[model samples]
Target chain A: MLIDIQNLVKDYQMDSVDVAALRGINLQVQKNEFVAIMGPSGSGKSTLMNILGCLDNPTSGVYRFNNTDVTGLNDDELSDIRNKHIGFIFQSFNLLKRMSALENVELPLMYAGIDKAKRMAMSKQALEKVGLADRMKHRPSELSGGQRQRVAIARALVNNPGMILADEPTGALDTTSSMEIMDVFKQLHTEGNTIIVITHEREIAACCKRIILIRDGLITSDTPNLN
Target chain B: MQQIRDNITKAILSLIDHKFRSFLTILGIIFGTASVIAMISIGEGTKKQAIAKYQDLGVSNIIIRDKDMTDAELQTVRMKFSKGLSVEDAKVISDVVPGVVSVSPQSEMKMEAKVGDRSAKASVIGVTPNIVSILNYRTAKGDFLTTDQYDRQLKVCVLGASIARELFSYDEPVGKSVKVEDQWFEVIGVMQPKALFTETVGELASRDLNNDIYIPLSTFNKRIPKVNPFTSDVKQLTVKLGNSEQLLPAAVVVRSLLNRRHFNNDDFSIIVPYELMKQEEKETRIYNLLLLSIAAISLVVGGIGIMNIMLASVLERTQEIGIRRAVGGKKKHIMSQFVTEAVVLSVAGGIIGVILGVTLSLVISWTTAVQTTITLYSILMAFSFSVIVGITFGYLPAKQAANLRPIESIRHE
Candidate 1:
């Protein structure tokens, strides 16, 4: 198993009231799996993704990545896990506005302390993989919605992490751009990459090999997608 | 090292992205550093000028001047058997005082000097041969009076530079005959112009030295009749000491001697240039300290301005900070990034401030009578102070930036 979670609970303090965002969730993910976590608004799906991505720690639980207990790790250790093992892709793309596509892709590598020459080479290869080889010099404001998402994907893939955790990866795209982004995900899955996407759309969930449905902070259904 | 370089590059790029905002942010530091440099330079220049003026007065010399009085006062002093400041006082100081190098006595009488039809009001000063060496006077043309001339009581005189120019125009005044009052005296030398004394020292009145004529004391006493029978033989006595360390002691000895010789009458005052110089230095030290504190306050205020801007910057870039934190940037990385930004701003401001300060000092010297000296240490101090201010003020904002929670900040939007 690449990811293991047990009895995960997250509570947010809101104006003197403890709101349970995630209630006693248990999950396990195997290597090279394409998984989609589906839920409506306020179902705690984003909170779960945040915990899974090592961006946030659970209030109480055991999270093991590659057999290492991650829940007990400190802030810097968690950042290292996020940098080396889990890559994040957001719905809004989150590409740095002032940087070109290549520079945005190079950001993670730069944080990883890679030298300039190799960082450039790796970022270029990632852009080529995302079919954005010619748009490397274009800034986020200069690119269309689909192209910006492609740059985000290139950035996520540049570090070659154990898993790519994308939250609502196609939530802001048109049908045509959505299909294009989904095709890229399918191609990456065929290339033996482990992927987990959080979304609410049924069509987006149907593209994954397995789907987990969450309602009211609990897992409602976990099964292989028939599509 | 590489991390620091990357952070610096990011800082510079971000500042360049918002050019006008960055410039405004550093304005306080610019003015602070410039004022610091300017203030210190002005203080230094004032000190140097004071020292030069004091040096011209011969710091190791002590002067005694006769008190100016009306004829009634002079008659009373004579009735009391006090001779005022006479050549006998100079002879007594030279003979009795220990560590006294030399003594020169001088007397002045204001009269009209004429060459042909051109005439100028000049103070005819009668001095002994040793007066030139005692007072640092130099002759620009011909030679000064010798002991032979003084002993022989020759009616020769040394014309002051301005008096020579006034009477003779461009022609050499040496060996020319000039009518002084009712007597015709031959000019043997002309003196170089001396620095003007604008303020009185003790009982000594300020006067234009370059308009005076110098003659042998023996000739002056025989030719120039006394304005009043109660007047003293000489007006002033200049006593040179072996070294500056003996000035106070010699002054004390000379004062007591004069008091006795004048029959316990307070008719003369002693002025020690070295003591006056030391007193002036002490006063200016307090003044310089006050100026430095004011400059320091401005720098602190400039530092506060940097903190204000940096705090706002951290707030506005919360999302950016989160993004950077999410991308494997550690807390130290974030902290150093912002700190480097602050340092860059201040260093740029420091360079500009140095340039502005040098220009300001130059402009001050050119436009006003007040002198300004820009020293290397002042520049270095101002520049380093600005850097220190940046780091000090930059710490709080950078810590706030580093301590932000990534999860919350990422979703701040």
Candidate 2:
């Protein structure tokens, strides 16, 4: 198992009242699995994704990633884990507005303390893989919607993390742009990259090999997609 | 180190982004440093001039002058068997006082000096031949009065540089005859211009030396009358000490000898140039301290401005900080980055301020007749102070930035 969550419970304090965001959740994700998490609004899908990405910790549970318990880790350690093992792609294509496509891809390597020359080479390779080799010098503001999303994908893959967790990766794009982003994800998956995307569109989820449906912070159904 | 370079590059870009705001922020520092350097340089320059002026008057000399006495005081002194300052008192001081190098007595009488066509009222000084070596007066045109001229009571006079020019313009004053007190005297020499000693000496009043006429003491006694009943025979006595450090001791010995000779009437007072020099130095030091404190306050205020902007910069770049942290930047890295930016700004400002300060000091000295000397230590001091101010004020903001939470910051809009 690449990720193991045992009896996870996440709660928020609203004026001294414990409002549960996720209650008694248990799940496991194996290596090389292209999984899609589908849910409606307020279904705790975002909260679950936050916990999975190490942006937030479970209120009470054991979260083991690659056999290391992550729930007890501190913020700095969690950041290290996020840098090393988890790659995040947001729906809005969260590339720094001031940086060029190449620089956006080099950010994670910079945090990892990689030397500049090697970081540049690796960033160039990541951009080429995303079909944005010629657009590496262009800022996100200058790129098209599809090109911005491709830059974000290039940044996510630059660190060679254990998994890519994208939340609504195609939510801000037109049909053609969305199809293009989806094709990149499909290609990544085919190249043996573990990918997880959270979205409500059934067609967007249909490309995944497996799907997990959640409602009200509880897993409702887990099954393979029939394509 | 790489982080610092990146942070400095980013800081420069950010400052360039808001050029006007950044300029306003460093204005206080600029003026503060410039003013500090200027004030210190001016103060130091004035101090050096004052010391040099005093040095020209011979810091090792002790002067004793005859006080102006009333008729009743003169009668009382005469009744108590006391004759006021005289040649005899100078003789006793030179014979008895230890460590005294030389003693010269001088008498002054305001008199008219006349050349062939020019006549000027000059203060005539009657002194012995020893007065020349003791007072450090050099002859510009002819020789000074010799012992033979003094013993024979010959009618000879030396004109001061200005008086020579006034009495004999374009003519060699060495062979000219000048009339003094309705008596004829040949001009022996022209004395060089002495340093202008503006302030009054103890018990001795001030007089301009530019229009002076020097004659022999024996001649003055024989030709000039004892007109003023309260006036002493001797006008002033300048005593030179072998070493400057022995001036105070010499003054004390001469004072006691004079008091005994005058029957403890205190008719004469002594002045030591070394004491006055020390006192002037003390006053100038206090003035320098006050100036330096004011400059220091301005530097601190400048530092505060830097801190204010740095905090705001950290807040504005929240997402950037989050991203950097996400990539792998440790807290130490972030802290050093902001600190380095601040240091770069302050160092650059320091160098510019130094240039500005030196230029300002030079301008001030030129426009006004003041002297200014910019030393290397002053520039180094100002530059280092700026850097220290940056580090002191940059710490809090840098720490605040380094301690930011990465998780929530990443999701911030």
| Ten residues in sequence with the least summed lDDT for candidate 2 chain B | B197-206
Off-target runs (Cα >4 Å) in candidate 2 are A190-192, B69-83, B86-95, B102-234, B242-245, B369-373
Candidate models: Cα lDDT each: 0.90, 0.84
Please give, for residues A29-113, the per-residue lDDT of candidate 1 as tens digits: 9989999999999999999998998888899989999899998899888888888888888898888899999999999898899
Over the stretch B20-45, how does candidate 1's per-residue lDDT look in tens digits?
88888888888889999999999999
Name the runs in model 1 displaced over 4 angstroms: A190-192, B115-118, B128-135, B138-194, B216-219
Question: Against the true structure, what is model 2's DockQ?
Answer: 0.39
Question: Positional deviation of A144 in candidate 2, in angstroms?
Answer: 3.3
List each candidate's DockQ score. 0.64, 0.39
TM-score of each candidate structure, all chains considered together? 0.91, 0.83
Task: List model 2 lDDT by residue over B1-413, tens digit each.
Answer: 66555668767876777778777767767777787788888888888777766665567788888877778887887788778899988888889988888888888889888887688889998989987777677898789999999999988999888888888888898977998868998899998887665666444466667678989988988888877665788888988888888888788888888888889988877878678878988998998899989998998999899899889878887777776665556677778878887787787778778888899999998999788878778778877898899888889999999898776676677
Residue-level error in angstroms, candidate 1, position B216: 4.3
